[model samples]
Target chain A: MTQNRTLSLSGERFTAVYHIVCKPAEAEARARDICVEQTIEFPEALVTDASIRDQIVGQVLSLQAVGEARFEARIGYPVEAAGRELTQLINVLFGNISIKPGVRLVGFELPESLARQYRGPRFGQAGLRALVDVHDRPLLCTAIKPMGLSPVALADLAYRLALGGIHLIKDDHGLSDQTFCRYEERVRRCAEAVERANRETGQRCLYLPNVTAPAGEIASRARLAKDAGAGGLLFCPGLAGFDAMRALADDDALALPILSHPAFQGTFCVHPDAGLSHGVLFGQLNRLAGADATIFPSWGGRFSFTQAECRDLVAGATRPMGELRTIFPVPGGGMRLDRVAELSDFYGRDCILLIGGDLHAHGPDLIESCRRFVAQAG
Target chain B: MTQNRTLSLSGERFTAVYHIVCKPAEAEARARDICVEQTIEFPEALVTDASIRDQIVGQVLSLQAVGEARFEARIGYPVEAAGRELTQLINVLFGNISIKPGVRLVGFELPESLARQYRGPRFGQAGLRALVDVHDRPLLCTAIKPMGLSPVALADLAYRLALGGIHLIKDDHGLSDQTFCRYEERVRRCAEAVERANRETGQRCLYLPNVTAPAGEIASRARLAKDAGAGGLLFCPGLAGFDAMRALADDDALALPILSHPAFQGTFCVHPDAGLSHGVLFGQLNRLAGADATIFPSWGGRFSFTQAECRDLVAGATRPMGELRTIFPVPGGGMRLDRVAELSDFYGRDCILLIGGDLHAHGPDLIESCRRFVAQAG
Candidate 1:
């Protein structure tokens, strides 16, 4: 966060850095267009209120050419434009401008007055580590997958994984409330199974069910998961809006840990000259939205993210932002058992080591394989 | 939609057409990877359950070359996998696959059973036309913007626009609950102003307030707008999830027509080979999610959508899909008064002609400008 604090704000304005792809001659005008487009959204001459034009409209503080035919513009908007809500803040940041081509929101700087307003990560990396009682080493985690599995099969797998000393067992992101394995039934079965295994082995294991649902059902579903004795909840902010997760995380009654999944948000980081940077979306935005742990496609996996991008994402998650807590970076897209040592070295002890399919790939005895994973990662 | 029916379903399976950019030799393997990746999300060999593999796993039905090193693959999954929910359907459609590069969801075919389950557009093009009592011509629309304006100023603008016979007057997407003009005061004042003008002019002008808020507050705000005498609602499915709009549109109590705005969804259509097509996103998906009228960047607007893409989008909206009604395509975004005749000829009378700043730019008398716009468009 320190290194990426490229936005130098003067007064009560929050700055956003946009990567504008255009010719050198068009850079200043394009930057100005964004300044107006993001704020007033009216023609400059028509805005009769002088104070509104001066205070409310966005101002381009600085512009520099980053590459050939591409300039990075740092535009500042009044913090009042974002209001006090995360939704409005997001809209003010990248609402209408998202429709235009060649303008990518690379990074943003929210002043401490505004940044601290958001209650980010009720239970961050330390709180999660405390829950599992694994303080010094990377926490071992896995997802129960192959979506068509029934509640009984999934719960049985959950029991074995818990018994084998896995810290966290999450439902696969694809495992929504389908008829084959309904949400309530699956959460109850898996939570109870994990509890039973915890009692037997004296090792705490959490069963996190995916609670991504429609806007009307999402909050109620989170409450349902909590009532069903689930340890934590798996939320996809991309599917449900980011503020949905923030609301869940901020709720005192359902004060459970949230692990944000990047389900439909990949497009934000996939392109270089358009959309958002990987760090801004997966890291800063996730943490700002109250994710205790964030899962992204790690390097050397099925996804196309490079090691440098992964490192930047980790930094964005853990870096200091006023008083916000640092969350765990769970990088688990196509991660294997053999890569644990190397990943642990790369991410260090602060991350949650997530190995999904490879846990089942190691021989017929799933419990033994989990134990071996625990031993190897430990 | 008729011409782009590339998907051929069998039995109870709904098909999806994916544009996979890969080497010509690797197209088959890549198509197979999408099948396994989208559904099971595990190694194909490791999925031992024959029934699960047969019933739930995504299957590639056909693969063909579309362009230079680009292949179009139609993949099918059990209808039950969608789980009678829009959120689950979206998750199943693009969830984990969005993170993967070169895999774009171009089109999809939902069986009549699956399509009918979704409440597409309660008040579609016909219903909206009935509301305004203007069935013969394009409904002229304008947005009251310059985000920092007070509620009184905005209300005055709304009044003039309504009095001048603009069919729809909506709050600019930028005009959220900012401190200058909170949502409550703004919606109430604007709605009352529009109603007052409607009373004077003996017309059915509708005031549409932008109710795009945090997930929990969206429905409540929509209800508040209805209670305040607002004739319709403007929602951004991109900011709030698509299902949010569906939830609002489907709610019987709030039976206001919804206009879907493309706020943060530009990234999905910006890339040709990475995300969804303009038609699939703005048209078919919006209508499926219950938007009565979909607002997108017109071809000649400040945005970069071409005439071809705009035409495709219109087709996706209006084309017959089982028993679903057609939605109005409101082509806007920097649209001017001078282009009204050309746009009308382009989009036909079924579309809503939205001109924002140009009306204000015409003269000091906004009502006169609105009257001129109505006369010209009419």
Candidate 2:
């Protein structure tokens, strides 16, 4: 597939592919408008010099009309224009154009220089597998549920899940620093409970607390979780900025495997021709932001993500991309224990199967349910 | 007129209203599911005690069928559930539920106790008006554009715009700390030029530099802009987290008014029945996060926002609320100088009219164009 056309630019440049749905007659004009909008956002006369036009302005590489009102426009931006920053790269990709309708960001072809700048996934699939000592099968994960539960109650649940051989136990994204369960107390108790369970069961079970908080408090909260002996961290990169997760992953003091949660990120992938492709938003972007495992609404779940989209996401996570490590695609949201075999076969061994509410449906025996979940995945 | 339905058993509870478009037969089930998904994401048996059910669980206040397959569901949560934090409040309102389709967050009825906790808009509409000394007329604002320009060129542009009596001069959200124009050098030079222009013209023209950066560097950049004598700050809250803006607003050291640039936020407001309402996402949320002025693509512009949606946004920004100050709705994106009269008449006096690329098209003289813009708004 000839996805991108080479632009004759002097310096390092990266290609950005967008799925534009507009009138076929207007496709060419719209493509030019995007190139101008993403760069100058001003009139043509503002380009005082030709070098600015050649170097700084985005160049349209290709424009192919796929459907009646659908065109795939590939534009190339100078690498220097991005300044090698993730936020700036995103701005260059779809910043102002996002406000305009009918433009959807589908894919990115980062130059080696630009792609290597981002330290993608500190502890990726292999590292996580090594950490949990679960190499031959899909990792079993679940959320410690019932938001109003006390720190003690949640810790007890974590302990039971750990003893039952779940590889990763994460906090429900709703579990923030609420009065009912303060962050520090909850982290300490949950970490201790998981450690106790690990000691008894002779297994490396990890407790990942949701550290999404006010920007200033996020680092401190992560530090506190680490000090409390928590194994990993779960972040809602959608609610908090994706860069926050990258910062935590890069932090030397609290170097733990990070899991990206898709809480408020649905808007990006929900629309067919507006925001971003499921593979790019849920898979590539999350991996680029240093998410060891990226969680999304699985197909046949409560959410509306399709099976094809989920397959694309898996491909995006494990695609060959320079030195960036492949991360785990944690399919979650309304996943059931009964579907464990099917999910494992579908996603293969390089995935994390997250089963939530259905774990409690088998009876009041949480431990037995979790064991059943682990066995089914195996 | 009555937007909220009071919950019978409530102590300082807040109401969250969602516009749900689902099958009439499934409206009740979907509403109940939302109440569960937003709060617990667990099964019913997880609610061990009645107190837990009453306090922790979200209660449906009212469900009114609006259309054949549309229903308005209002759910109430205890104010304490949010922990008096903006991030937590968002999580409580729509975290896990964002992935679910046919649900849109329309309105939030925050109690005084909850609303007052956020230091919303340090310099709100009145405060900004007082700062710029513009009364009985809409404020004139424009972005200093042509992204590849040098710092000196940008400073010259800022000087020309300030001399023309433009109230607010903001960096095009695309202008970040790039090699062409470093953040500190651009901010310092622009602040000096604006100050020099202000001194000569005897006008209070504020220069707001775009301080959107990596999570850790945001505060330092904000501090640099303030220390460089920049009058206010421009933040892309969509790219950076909203909490980052709130932290800057709440920072005692840098108390400058913030103007939020709607760069990557359009995804949430574009879809009608998926993400968020025009008023809630762009207006109420921006005010809550401490944007003294919020910028969005104006109606009939290059963007797809409608006039009615713009009106709703204005109302959401300026409407009476509990202690949260009213913010200015700065409408930009393809606004032409010729439409100043029509826009002014439609948006009324409480708006910041942003005229961008058109200012450059009128003539080579930017100052003269800005003067004409100011005169037209008047």
lDDT of 1: 0.87
Per-residue CA lDDT of candidate 1, range B1-378, in tens?
001112222349889889999999999998888888778888878877766677778888999998999999999988878877887788888888888889888788888988999889998899999999998899988898777778888898889889988999988988778767789999999999999999999999999999888777898999999999999999888888888889999999999999899988999888888878888899988998999999998998889999998998998898877778899999999999888899999998999999888788876888888888888888
Q: Go through the candidates in order and give each one's DockQ.
A: 0.45, 0.45
DockQ versus reference, model 2: 0.45
Listed for each candidate, the true contacts retained, as a fraction, are 0.64, 0.59
Model 1 regions lying over 4 Å from their true place: A1-11, B1-11
Considering just the first chain, candidate 1 attains a TM-score of 0.95
| Candidate 1: Cα lDDT at B334 | 92
Q: Write model 2 residue lDDT over A175-282, tens digit each, in one string.
A: 889777888999999999999999999999999999999998999999999999999999998888888888998897888999899888888878787888888887
TM-score of 2: 0.96
* Candidate 2 stretches greater than 4 Å from native: A1-10, B1-10
Q: Compared with the true structure, what per-residue lDDT tens digits does model 1 show for residues A104-197?
A: 9878888898998898999999899888888888898899877878888888889988998899999998898877778888899999999999
In order of appearance, the predictions have TM-scores of: 0.96, 0.96
Which 10 consecutive residues of model 2 chain A have the lowest summed lDDT?
A: A1-10
